[model samples]
Target: MVDRDIVGGNWIEVPAGKYKKNARTLSHCQLEFNCLYSDLISHAAEGDYSKMAPFRVLSFDIECAGRKGHFPEANHDPVIQIANLVSLQGEDQPFVRNVMTLKSCAPIVGVDVMSFEAEREVLLAWR
Candidate 1:
């Protein structure tokens, strides 16, 4: 099967902008047809009303302390020891005993790409 998927839009790249998000990537019209939007549509077709609900989801890049330090003069050693995933639900627990590192991601709950924001962690629609 051939996948005819494409993402991008026509917007002029600006230079020397005061705004933090000062970059041109995609247009407003084009943004409406993103993969996430398509997933919602597919859910609607399947009569899944839960997809119509609004929820708070955030994606973030954490500045980890272990590897890739500042400056070219600094060493970029691979990090083997790193603290991870502390859920805020109850005192922030850590994964312990029989620790396993996932080599590849198994399908979460669907085949429609990753419904997650990259990390499996989500606040959930009702969690």
Candidate 2:
């Protein structure tokens, strides 16, 4: 389902049109709207962004398992880890940083993480 209606999103000139504020694109989005990238994921997670919706921000990074030099093809590359800071609208400080993995991984200080036996296990745990 479309999380937010595209018609109500903030419009942009470069992308040319209105789009959802916190929408994730599994495929190509419409040409005429502003779609929120990772920069706006926090807004979606908090469910409130009126105070700081205009600024572009960096959230976290995803680490995938593959050869160093050659990028792994779509079916080969596996998403081995994800780390992010989570803060709600009323929270005083963001503290839900975590890194999930599919194998034994070194613990990141001050962050919660666990390694699973299978990739599907990781997805289920994350959800």
Clash totals, every prediction: 0, 3
Q: What's the lDDT for all of these models?
A: 0.27, 0.59
lDDT of each residue in 48-108, candidate 2, tens digit only? 5333444323256677788879886647888777667776665666757777788879877
Clashes by residue pair, model 2? 17-32, 17-33, 18-33
Residue runs of model 1 more than 4 Å from their true location after superposition: 1-41, 45-48, 51-78, 86-127
Count residue pairs with overlapping backbones in model 2.
3
TM-score of the candidate numbered 1?
0.18
Ten residues in sequence with the least summed lDDT for candidate 2? 38-47
Candidate 1 lDDT score relative to the true structure: 0.27
Highest TM-score model number? 2
| Ten contiguous residues minimizing lDDT sum, candidate 1 | 95-104
lDDT of 1 by residue, 9-120 (tens): 2122223332244256554432322232222211122244332333223223222224345532214432211112323333334322111111223443322222233221
Query: C-alpha displacement of 90 in model 1, angstroms?
Result: 11
